[model samples]
Target: MIDPRRLRVLRALAEHGTVTAAARALYMSPSAASQQLAALEAEAGHALLERRGRTVRLTATGAVLAGHAARIAAQLEQAEADLAACSAGLAGEVTIAAFATAITEVVAPALPALRARAPEVRVRVKDAEGPASHRLLADGEVDVAVAVEHPGPLGVGDEQVLLHEPLYAEPFDVVLPQGHRLRADARVDLGALRDDPWITPWPGNPVHDVMVRACEEAGFRPRVACLSDDFRAVCALVAAGTGVSLVPRSALRGGLLGSASGGVVVRSVGGRRPTRRVFTAVRRGSQSHPLLRLALDGLRAQAASLAG
Candidate 1:
């Protein structure tokens, strides 16, 4: 009988054009690839490859086989995905890749409600910025993603919008160590901290880029004291007096504050505005998932409470 593994080998050889390259991609040695291809030919009872100079070319039979193999490969993948999605007893995982602020301020609150509704559903998180999350969604690596839009500059990519929540009307105040000298002021001016080292998110994310620009607009370059995309960690560091940070106003409202405290104060900067806009994204057709819809409904309800 023609084995699917052999058919896969045949497909790979056709796609890559050489046993050497195909073997490397398949993580097999060239000799192994050749052996497998020969075995496949024997099983199929036909010539699948032909010599063209030092290279090989697919015969007409090979082309016909490759076509069938492609369909077979797709069906196999889809079958596996469906089985995983359906077998878990309210369990199947729904992975979410989100930008820093949304996960910290928005999604964090709803996790408990999600688990309560479908205790079997395993929710996983990834750090994917707004534009990049679309690629992950398209590729099927993540089932949901919470992305951000920075007011006028963001393009929504090809992502389907699920929920949009205005978490903070403006960007957060720069958190200072508790009992820091500036806490006494009504709102410390950005000019004072211009020379201070700042704790901010890493690059390739919106928050990092926004804070950097917020500082430059304040007329002085900021010294980034620590870098991370984790919201809780950022707060912990600030509480530890590691360095100051810019945080969303919503940070003041959640468990994100934790027990960590350093008598941190918050203040505003001048020039470029500090607030950011955020959006929730999922695959264009993914709302069909029962849990995905429930999750979004819970999110919107909680957001309305927050907004009020």
Candidate 2:
């Protein structure tokens, strides 16, 4: 009989494409993960992994087993959910992953309400970006994830193991230094800032992609003077008269910009304003669990409050 835990490790290895990455995601050391996979191979009586130069790939048999592992994992999740439903009480722990801004504006505000509504249910929060959070949720390391929709298809391998619950649409705003010419405008036009130095997120960041696309639509590329992933740092740079940046309105509301000195102003972006859809995701099988449902309700309430 195959150990379900070993099957899970194999599934993680399949999903992550590397022993080190899978081990980190599973919160295990590389040696332990290797041992588990080796034990799994012994049980299956076939090799599951082929090591290349500095990487590992699934063998033919490994791929087949991975498919079975995914189904078994999903079935196990369903069983757990069914058992939780039998109890019909919000008494278990629910882990959530979210980005920084959402942690402050959505999850933090929802915590008090969740505690009040279901004192027996414990909540754990992990701060991560949308893609990373979704990866954690997919790997079953997290019960739910709060994430933003990017400009493409969702999830690696297109498995659709997670179901989304839309929360709110967050619009981007332009952050400008005080006394800058653009700060005088109620809504800043992206084209107007084409010649100005820009402060934006690093390359490949979702927000950076949004900024780039917004500028492209305006018919020019931004002259990025500085790059930082931290919204607060972006705001601080803007406050210190370094360069302007685009940030989600949610970040401003969450005190990212407010914490910066008074040398910056936020304005709406003119012409087809860019926005990201913020949503919560849970494994399809576990969405109906009492604890998950209660926690989702708390999140929905907080999102509604933010929208209002």
Candidate 3:
């Protein structure tokens, strides 16, 4: 019979390109990972890996086996959850991956309640950005992902593998340097700033897409001046007279009236404002697991508290 442990190593290799990376994820040395793969190939009686010039590529057969390994891993997780459910109150560990503000504003706040509900349920947090959180959830590296909602990447087909639970929608606030033409306005008109140079997140980020689409709907494309993913840095750039940009309301620590002292003014948009929705994603069938369910409910409660 093919060994399940070796299959896990193969699946890790498929998820992470390099054997070194796969070995690191598995917490094994490179030489030991290679030996496991060699043993698996012998069991399968086929060449599963092709090695050339310090790189490794899976053979077609290896890819097929890796796919099976992924399914088997999910099944094992389900089995573990089932067995844990038989024992006691929430008692298993749940690892969640999320970006900065979500951790500070949502996940961290939810923890005290989760601990009160189930002291034995451990929740581990990993720092990950937008797509990386989802990727980690898909690869079985994380049990839950606090991710921003986006199209194309997590489409209908992913429903079979993931269950997305939207937590909140945060509206974008326009951040302008002091003394700009529209700084003193009660609500900034997006169309009036058509000629202004804009700071934006790099292309492909969810926030960047929202900024571009909001500008396009306002009738012109924003002329790009700088790119940064960190909202703090974006605000800093605006303070230095770099350019104006749309920042999510949650990223700013204080309220709109309180955030104007740093040489940058934050104002609401006049027309239809663009917003990004944040959600928690988990494996499809795993949400009902006792520990995971409690964690999800705690997050929802915390999100409601924030919205209030």
Candidate 4:
């Protein structure tokens, strides 16, 4: 019989791509993780890993087994949820991984109501961006993840193991330096900013991708003047006349940059509106648990409030 614990190690190995990374996620030493894999291979009477120097790749049999392990993990979560339903009312801890804006605008705002309604339920929030949050969810590190819509390791095909729920969609606003030529316009034309230096998030960030794609569609590429992932820093640079930028409506609500009274102007873009869609994702088969359900409902309520 396959040991479920060792199978989890194999699943981690497959998800993380390196023994060291897998061990770090599992809170195990590298040697212990390797030992677990070796034991798993012994149980299967097959080589489950192809060692290449310090790195390793899952063998065909190992990959197949890892897939089964994921399904089994989901089933186990379902069993736990079923058991919890029988015990009592909502009373458990739920950890959420979210980006900066969601934490401030959505998750944090919903907490008070959750506390009032179910005082026994606890929530822990972790700050993480989209791709990172998905990894945390897949590794079973977070019970829920608030993420922007983007291509991630946990794609639509993994819906059987995960639940994707759309929370809200907010348009990106054009942020311009004070006294800029385009500030007089109600809706800033993207093409008009082609000549202006751009302040954008560092490459590989979802917001960065949005800026690039929007600019390309606008008939020119953005000439980057500064790169920062922090909206506060981005707004600060824009206020200092470093360059113009794109910011989400949610970030604006967080007061990253003050308002028109501050040394910057925020306006919507012309043509097709570019938006960032935020959503909450949870592990499949566990969404029905009372604690998770309450959390999800609270998040939905907060998102609705933002929309209103």
Candidate 5:
């Protein structure tokens, strides 16, 4: 019989593309990882990897075995989850990954309720973006992931082994200097800022994509004056009268606005407003685990409260 541990090592190698990387990910030394793969090859009676210069590629048999390995790992995880569900008490740690704002607005607010209802269940939180959080969920590194969904058709590659539950839709508001001409208006038109310099989130961020798309829909491209990953810094830049920006409403809460440049003012965008849908994702079969279910419920409740 093939050892499940060896199968896991093989799968990790396939995913990470190198022995050293796989070893680091799995918390093993390179020599031990190589030995495990050798043992796996002996069990299968075939070579599983082809080494060429500095990189390693999986052999045909390795690819086939790795696919089976993935299914086996998922099945084992589901079996464990099923067993956990049969227990009388809900007591376990659930690790969740989410972005910065969601951590404050969604996850943190739900903690009090979670503690009250399930004192035995502990929650661990990690800050991660959409793609990174999804990857962590797929790898079973996190029990749940809070991610942002943008506007567009889902691609074939977007299919995941996780279950998704929609939480809430958060609107984006324009942030401007107090002295800016549009600050006096109750609702600012995005097109009105066509010629104004913009301070935008870095590329590859979901918020940045939303901002760019919203501007394009308004019949103009944003003239980016600066790029920042931190929304607080973006707010400060706006307060400094450097450039205008769009920020999610959730970020404006929790003293973030109070600490920002006093010269900053927020206004809603007129017409169709840009919004990001926040969703919670969990591993397919583990969603029913008592601890995970409790956490999910708390997250849903918090989101509903925010929406209300």
Candidate 6:
């Protein structure tokens, strides 16, 4: 019979790409991981992994098995959660993935309160770009993920819409150093930036697409001056006069440079609004998990001011 534990070990090995890495992620010794995988292979009567120079990669069959393993692991985790809920306290670890602002504004503030009330529940965070963040959720790498839902679609799973508050209602702005030539105008016409240097994120990132679409709507292609996944770094580059960025006013709290701030300015296009609609997401089937529910409730309460 195929042992679930052995399948899990193989799944970890497949997901991590190396026995040593899988062992580290699973919190087991490399030898133990190898042993379990060996046993699983023996039970399955086939070669699940193929050897490379110093590592192993999943075979086609192994990849299929790993997908099943993920579903099983999720069900097992939910089962454990249900059992834990029957006890006196909420207890379990939940990994969360979120974009930059949510980590600082929403997650940081809400965690302390949530932890105090449910001391048994442990939370960890993985900083991710929006589209990437949702993929992490779909991959079973995290329990919850927070992201903005603007032109790019978010996950179709169960969601707790947090920005039900009015953080702001304005067009996204072009941020630059305090003394750029355009700062004088409250809104710069997009056509004027046809030849302007721009800083943006990696191609697949949510913000990168946002910039592209915004520029497209403005009837021009942005001349990308730099590539950075770090939102802070993107702003720093803008502050250093390296390039200009389209950022939400909220993010300006950290990225705007003084002299550069006066020089660089956010300008709204005639009718184009480059804005993000932020929300909290949980697996639709996972609402029964108390930790997920409570965290959403706390997020709602904290976001009351913004959602309004």
lDDT of 1 by residue, 134-178 (tens): 556543467776666643333222312223444334456778888
The positional error of residue 35 in candidate 1, measured at the CA in angstroms, is 18
Deviation in Å, model 6, residue 86 alpha carbon: 1.7
* lDDT (tens digit, per residue) of candidate 6 on 156-220: 22132111222223246677566777767777776677778999888877668878888888888
lDDT of each: 0.68, 0.85, 0.84, 0.87, 0.85, 0.70
The TM-score of candidate 1 is 0.57
Name the best candidate (by TM-score): 4
Model 2, span 87-178: residue lDDT tens: 85568798999988888998988998899888888899999885888888887779989988777655544353678879888789999999
- Candidate 2's displacement at residue 283, Å, is 2.5
Worst 10 residues of 5 by lDDT: 152-161
Model 6 regions more than 4 Å off: 16-21, 27-31, 50-57, 91-95, 112-143, 147-171, 176-186, 202-205, 217-219, 227-233, 253-263, 277-286, 300-308
TM-scores for the candidates: 0.57, 0.90, 0.85, 0.95, 0.90, 0.72
Report the lDDT tens digits of candidate 4 across residue range 1-308: 78989988988888788899889989999999999999999999999999988889999998888888888888888899899989867788999999988998999999999999999988999999858888888788899999888754554225656788999999899998887988889998899889999999987788898889999999999999999988888988898998999999888875567543398988989998788888999887888877898999999999997773
Count clashing residue pairs in model 3: 0
Q: In model 2, where do residues sit more than 4 Å from their true spots?
A: 29-31, 42-47, 51-55, 152-155, 259-261
Give the C-alpha miss distance for residue 176 in model 2, angstroms.
1.3
Looking at model 2, residue 292 earns an lDDT score of 86
Candidate 5 clash total? 0
Model 5 agreement with the true structure over 183-248: per-residue lDDT tens digits: 889999899999999999887788899999999999999999999978899999899889999999
Q: Is candidate 3 or candidate 5 better by TM-score?
A: 5
